[model samples]
Target: MKALIISDSHGWTHELKTIIDRHRNQVDVIFHCGDSELSENDEALKGVNVVRGNCDFGDDFPEELIESVGGVTFFVAHGHHYNVKMTYVPLSYRAEEHQANVTCFGHSHVATAFMENEVLYINPGSIRLPRQHPQGTYCICEYDEKEISVTFFNTHGENIPELTVAFKRK
Candidate 1:
């Protein structure tokens, strides 16, 4: 299965559309990790599984979403409630509670991916305002019964090799 994971667009509607468009034919699932600052019904958000971010106001969105797509269990969130800017400890527990194997989130605006406690945690970073990297970033993952591989890309659609990671599914 292939999934496009993005976060922290923070109001750059066109960029979001472009990114989705660029990978439209390549992914089976699309997850937006919030901070879009757009309404839940916005055209750009259509067909996307999104969670509420700190910047997203009102009760327009849920605090989190847990879904199974293409046989993969995903726990999606914006990470403020769990203090993602500090650590993934709290978020990990929540994912564990849901028995999720993949956890996707955004809040720290830093792109990272890792395997811990037999679960994969991914932060696609901020596609608008990024830190720790020169350009804003996002990620795509290819997975199956054996392994999961994630590759980060810049706004222009070029892959950031240094951020790409793959893990043997246990």
Candidate 2:
């Protein structure tokens, strides 16, 4: 299965829609890591799994989400509550508790992906305001029985070659 992960849009609905439209048919699922700043009933989030961020004021948004797709369990969060900018310990512990194969979050607006303790952790970065990277980015993950491949893309749908990574499932 393939999943498209994005975060920290911070209210640029048009960009979000463009990204979603660009990959809607190609990916099996779409995840918005938070700070969307859009209302819960907004069309931009119609079919995406989303969470609440520190900047989000919507009462309808959840703080975290657990989703199962193609035999893989995913732990989703905005990461502020776990203090992800300082450390991953809290988030990692939460993932372990959920028995998640992958953990998706956004907070620092840094694009990064890695595997630790058999769990894949990914932060798609901020499409509206990037920090560590030159371009605003998001991530696409393709997974199967043997391995998982993650590719980062710019807001314009261009791939960030150097950021692409693959890992063998444990």
For all candidates, what are the clash counts?
0, 0
TM-score for each model: 0.97, 0.98
Residues 42-124, model 1: lDDT tens digits: 88887888899999998988899998988889999999999998889999999999999899999999999999998899999
Q: How many residue pairs of model 1 clash at the backbone?
A: 0
Please provide, for model 2 over 1-170, each residue's C-alpha lDDT reduced to its tens digit, 9 standing for 90 to 100: 99999999999988999999999999888999999999888888889999999999958689999999988899999999999999999999999999999899999999999999989999999999999899999999998988998999999999999999999876
TM-score of 2: 0.98
lDDT values, one for every candidate: 0.93, 0.94
Q: After superposition, how far is residue 90 of candidate 1 from its true place, in Å?
A: 0.6
lDDT of 1 at 152: 99
Identify the candidate with maximal lDDT.
2
Displacement of the residue 136 alpha carbon in candidate 2, Å: 0.5
